[model samples]
Target: MTTQIKMTEPQMLQQLLKQGFEHLNQGQIREAADCCQRAIHIKPDLVPAHFLVGLVALEGQDRKTAFQAFNSVTTLQKNHPAAWAQIAKLCMSDGQINLADNALKQALKYPNKDPMVHDLLGTVLSKMGEHKNARKCFQEAVTLQPNHPPYMLNYANNLIYQGELEESESVLEDIIRIQPNSPQAHWSFSGAQKATNTKHIETMQSLVSEKNIHPRSLPFYFYAMGKEYEDLQEWDKAFESFSKGAKARRETVEFDEAHEVATFKHIEDTFTKEWFEQDQKGHSSDAPIFVLGQPRTGTTLVERIITSHSQVHSAGELQQFGLAIRRLSNHQDPRRFSPQLFTEALKLDPQKIGGLYLQTTEKLSGGKPRFVDKLPQNYLMIPLILKALPNAKIVHLTRNPMDACFASYKQLFADAYLHSYDQAEMARHHARYRHLMDVWRERFPGQFFDISYEATTSDLEPNARALIDFLELPWEDTCLHFHEQKTAVSTASSIQVREPAHTRSIGRWKHYEQQLSTMMSTLHEQGVPIDN
Candidate 1:
């Protein structure tokens, strides 16, 4: 008879940790957590157990638990790359970008590197406006896994920001040759360069017509088709494709109009002259200049012009100010900004909020005297910004309502501006935004500067001069030649902003006026003037 030997406690702990990792790989979150807990029970300071626990929490979308568990792993083994990487991801999701940057740096220092970690670090670095470093990280990711579609796609996308459009298209074509089923690759390919013929357009069209296409990928395919058609001046075809794409996208998102309405209404009702005037002293740093408005409304154009000045740098679309508001208000809701969160924020001391915001953005400010925080949605947080950083210059961008709505409608956003997919929803949302702005102007007259997109494009030199004057900066001819700036623009307007300002997009919306009847009618119903 063969004797059965019982495993020792150390061996048993090893078995549990191994089992936890296997379960995690198999997508068994609860089983993985249980195994991790059992391992921790035997050895409380077990780094592997804590790391496994963090992984489980991440899979379950419990960022708080994941952060705590990862912190424990770091405490046990400070040089643990995986743990630090996980912590960086959690911090990024929390809008603690500087902390995320630090954690990512730590993760990158250790030899036990993950390709995904490299890709993530690249994204974080790109967001921080470190284009060259970000490109290296992305290229390294592809090196780690050659011809890997995801990694290759990231590298190709980054090339666009670097203004290497031909190279980007070449890489995208290689991806298509490798993986024919990639809707995202096709979409990126379409937007990489202006289409002069029906080369890739036919390929995308065929992909969409395939019966086996994924439901989730329909929007990407359709949007690609829409863009190419628009480039070819096929307005009817473009409208149809855009409409189908919008419909498909709208179905995938869970957008609630009530939440937005309530949030805007709260801002209008609560944040008034009296509210801000009471206990008004804030952080004294005039380092932050905000360029904000609705997305696709020339915020990037304005930002490029301002940042072209020697005294200023672009902190691309920072979440710091809004995050400061959320943190100071003890916000728990993941909706970013809600009526409840806004209500809670009313009790905050503006100085503390201002201090917190500056602390978070200090790294991104570089050595420049002023840095533009070009987050378009920060328009909603204007009152908080003024109350906290009174000296912060806020430039609001205005575009023709039809052009603005149409611009957003045709674009495929990764995650934001949820109301843009549907014509009626976008129109109504713009109306609400306009209403809030009017109240803000009434409460804080001449506190913020407004620049019209049409006027700026039509009279680039004079408008650029006025913009510079408003910021109290010395006149620089470089500001007028903003398109000549070598800094990478990582916004949707990356391509357009890199070229000389033009009025081509001004009357372009008129081509689709018949197709966008719902948008026009909705704007009329909401009382938004359509100047074009």
Candidate 2:
């Protein structure tokens, strides 16, 4: 006598869903999507299957498909917190702040929302410049899930942005204690320590060597070492460490004569006035105040002075301009610019571009009226910027080319910038940059202003006055006292920005005369004035 086994279709669907979820947890999105699709085929009403499918689509960067999938989940399960959170993240990426905010608000309406929902909301708020609100959300997230390192790290990041170094240190310490092997936590912790205590420099160096930290971490570690050496006025060691970091990540050398000729050819072939005009038409006529030049060229100092005025706000080097250009290109290769591409770019809605920029920046600087985008590399993008925002003012900060190149070559930038380390490459790139600027100046005379770093540092008052007038802002005494400004300095020149203006940095490249001999000759041949 054998008993017949009976299984319902619903039971099979449930089993598949379980298996799908397990695969999802193991990071097998494709496999999980297949299982979930099978489950949905068996039980078409299964909302979780739709949700899982949506997540898998997102992993594949198919936003439209993901949106449809998530929309299906919401149709089936109206109050799904996870779905709402996903919508918020999508909106944030698209630069849709109000929509992101509304979605997160809806997510919170559901009971027992995941701590991650709060964390995402916090990131959105931080980008919007609502630091206080962002801090509250991050704090709540950490409290709800204390063991989560990411949440703690984000909370610490907020603290660092607010210029609250001690508080950030405390948060980082807790994170390190919870997960001792976290390289990021240690690196960030080291950064905070470097800011507050010059004495901790030796300790950081020791840790870097002993831990055999990741290569990516080398730049920051060396940067910290350079800062310490600079603080001690140990110029040789500072130069060596800075050079090491720069050399490790150099993409190309700027000063090389051969590289210079190649770069000149590329610029002539690639960038043109018409190309800029098209880019300009894509953005609003309202030009942003661009502060650009070589790194350590007093651009940051100028920004600090200008931002100290009542009307101006300091926005750190904007990653957005590069992002905006990429978006406007619409996947068209920048190396292959054509009239059709220009026409397509020109037709982009200015209001949309401006609104997106304002939305993204509004969250970063706490809703300041006049913000600064102090990215040094914006020098290369000047044409695009001028075209996009015709009403925008351009401040071209100039330092002695030799000094600027030397400073660039010796610094360990966080991101890989090609020409910084190689002397010949650095010289060539610098020449190309100058040539482009000359063309831009000839094209748009009054719109661009050149402020020498020497003038700005040697005589702070006149330069400050000139800068204020250029920005069309009322002169404030505090602009002269930018060192006293209590804002968070995020760049490598952070410590330098905290002090009064000085000429000590000017012409400091002469000390490495032997090493920079080739660069010097290249600068002279390019007709760049070199005193040394």
Candidate 3:
């Protein structure tokens, strides 16, 4: 037989690119990324190679690499709408909404039929406080790709945000019809609080126990089942479902309790009362009304009320201050409150850090005099916040420990909520949170207004008025009807906040008190006062 002729470089590149796409589709992310890199080496200007590399990098969670690769695609082809679309997505994730908007506009300027670009543009607009424009983008995306579940879901979310609940429910049902096996579609519909269909619930329950289904989908399936059980008032079954959901979620992320302990210890030691008493200058802005607490502790409820006031803007869960800490620490970890970082944050110029946060938020506020930053974990950064924005009002939300922690445990966050995965860990974190709050009270006397969920829900108007007075806002009846406000809440409380304030959530932890024994023991060991 004649000797086999070696394939040419172009042939090799084509073969590699095809292999990369195949591997990418098959969930072999590293292998796909490697193939793309090899293709890029053989043909540096290959647009498909660069695009695949960006996609693989994004899937592998290397956003920096993805940004560069996608940017490269644009350089090679100026009218590349797909590249611009990805650039917009990456920019949004990096908290660059303005840039994302510009990128999306560029993407739409081209003759592109891609629904994802329109979908992403919708999300960017929503985050920028452009609800009407966002809805339009979502509508266009859904029209272009009627069968795509994600497009339908995004459109449904926008519809819900605009108080079109019936329309939103219809779209969600359409999603279930199109993709009957889609766990996310079923899970999303459960949040509408209208899951009366026994067939759908049974289908989701069966999906949860199916070993053939995706492992990542298990968390959502379990949580969806939990929601159904809770709706039916099967308390024990509900708790069991929620526990499985939390366990499945925890398996996906590595959260070290030791690391968390070390981090909190660092915060306690670094930001003392004596530290605040020092002659330090900070950026002064009455614009910031900080609502700080553990997650699910009525921070969102209070935010809804506060933002309903005409003068206040709702900048949901800002990461700017946390970003500032990361800037000082020189650590890339988005969670910047660790021992390795806090000391460095303490050493930085407070005014500069404070100024950056205000500037970033003001752009999002649309000239509103006051804006709410309802980042619950900002409790850990209270000292940093106080030292940076001295004139800002702080609203500390307190909930019954069991209610707060258990509520958090039941949620499957879009991102990592490491502490919420385990009850004992959650209790430990709550104790640390309470300790820090006490420290804040001791150091900055009369500077904080503590709002209790139980107290507020028990007597709504009186506490609502107190909260308004604390913000130095003139009383408006709008605050009393926060649910009537058109602005959509993007939190776990999204559905709950749509209804009038009620005490149904009060003493909710009693339903599963037996299951929470480990958490209760941990809280007691840490000197937290459990209720009678």
Candidate 4:
């Protein structure tokens, strides 16, 4: 028979926290959360326990648990800046920017001078399209901790987002000088500049091989290495680097292929053409001009061009639509909001839905006649959008199928978009996306203006003129000079759009044909309309 040993209260709490962290690191979210909750039971006022649980819940996409845990930490420790910062982070991730802003302000009032708080605040401000204020926050963070690479990197990113590419390049150079081993700095720098020579290729290759580098950092460095190789026209090497980067990212990020497939099927089944043909009335606000398509398409370029007009403002990918849908369904997590829930929302007053959309966007409009919503993923909500904003102008952008898929595969997304890591998954998703668009087109004839990326780039003047005509607005010279505008572009195409219109990305996927064979075959199998 074994004898039972009794442990002290403090010892038990410490052991619980340690076990929770071990589970969390191993990706056992449920076990980690249980351990953390047990630790919290042992000591109700334990800040670390609450915070750890919050992080675990966040990883598992349980927004309610994470929000409550973080909120509890703030309540338990009134002056806890870190807790407030975590709250702000969760809010931002949920697309609650105003709440995040308020939380960041509270975090700043605390005595702790962690540059991280200020850095995060800067990111929030950027998300709100407040670039000037964001620049100030970034500058303050860099001032408070000049040697911190993350703060400096954020400062550099803010600069780049606001079209200050040269200054951003300077800041990135300083970061590289200060911390030579920082893969993030190198990766961001590559995005900001095009290389003429392969001088840094050998150094990047060696750094990627170094076992001392952090696992999280390798993906960024690998992508940067791929960009360099692509610039040099070394196709095989570029494919190798990009493949490694995508694989590295897939290891840690959680994406559900099954959920994605189900979501698409739910959408198709629920929003039948007959459902749209039913009598429904929406708020008569034609103030929104939605520009949507798959990522890496010309959506950003189109939005910039349209918002360049005097009567239009750019809202820069607002989450208002997603948030509105969540509120309507009373859902905790937007991703988990089921098709049945959406069907239930369809029975609600369309005016209320449309009103919420306008109220959320109008504040950002500053009384402009039109505001452009450049959310690419908004394509998924096309049916709901048409029902809510019947008078809204929808501008749908398209690109060559292979180029679009390849472009998405090459970049490292900050949040979700799990299918981007695998070529066939990406292609299949694109097929579904295209099919949905086709359904929408049949449901609402003469409702959307289609703009092909290749066609627009091939004949900029005429195509832009036609788009302006579609909007019932006269063309302005400034529309052609959209890149010269001072407004911030928060998308991945920020750097590329700052340059003049070009055909460089037109057939980008052709260079990696061998590597993307799986994608090409999948697209063909799924009937994704590959003209090029």
Whole-model Cα lDDT of every candidate shown, in order: 0.88, 0.71, 0.83, 0.84
Summarize candidate 3's per-residue lDDT along 428-511 as a digit string, tens digits: 988888887887788778878999998888888999999999888899999989988877777768888888898998888888
Candidates in order: C-alpha RMSD to true structure: 2.6, 5.7, 2.4, 4.5
Segments of candidate 1 deviating more than 4 angstroms: 1-52
Q: Write model 2 residue lDDT over 9-83, tens digit each, in one string.
A: 877887788888788788788888899889888778789889888888887778877888877887888798778
What lDDT tens digits, residue by residue, belong to model 1 across residues 79-139?
Answer: 9877887787778767787788889889888885478767877776777778888899889
Q: Compared with the true structure, what per-residue lDDT tens digits does model 4 show for residues 1-532?
A: 9998999999999999999989998999989989997998878899989989888988897878888988998899878777787788777666666678778788879876777667777777776677888898789889989878889998998898888889999999888888888888899888888877877778788887887877888889889989988888898998999999999998878777777777778887888778887888888988999999998889998998898899899988888886777766666544643566566667677778888877666556747888899888888878888888888888999999999999999998887578899888899888888888887888778888999999988888888999999988878988888878888888888888887788988998888888889999999999876764
Clashing pairs in 1: none
Ranking by lDDT: 1, 4, 3, 2
Q: Of the candidates numbered 1 and 4, which has the greater TM-score value?
A: 1
| Ranking according to TM-score, highest score first | 3, 1, 4, 2
Alpha-carbon deviation at 11 in model 2, angstroms: 8.5
Q: Largest TM-score belongs to which candidate?
A: 3
Candidate 3: stretches off by over 4 Å: 1-16, 97-102, 108-111, 196-198, 334-336
Question: In model 2, where do residues sit more than 4 Å from their true spots?
Answer: 1-87, 94-113, 195-287, 294-296, 315-369, 375-377, 402-427, 484-499, 502-532
lDDT of 4 at 428: 88
Which number leads on lDDT? 1
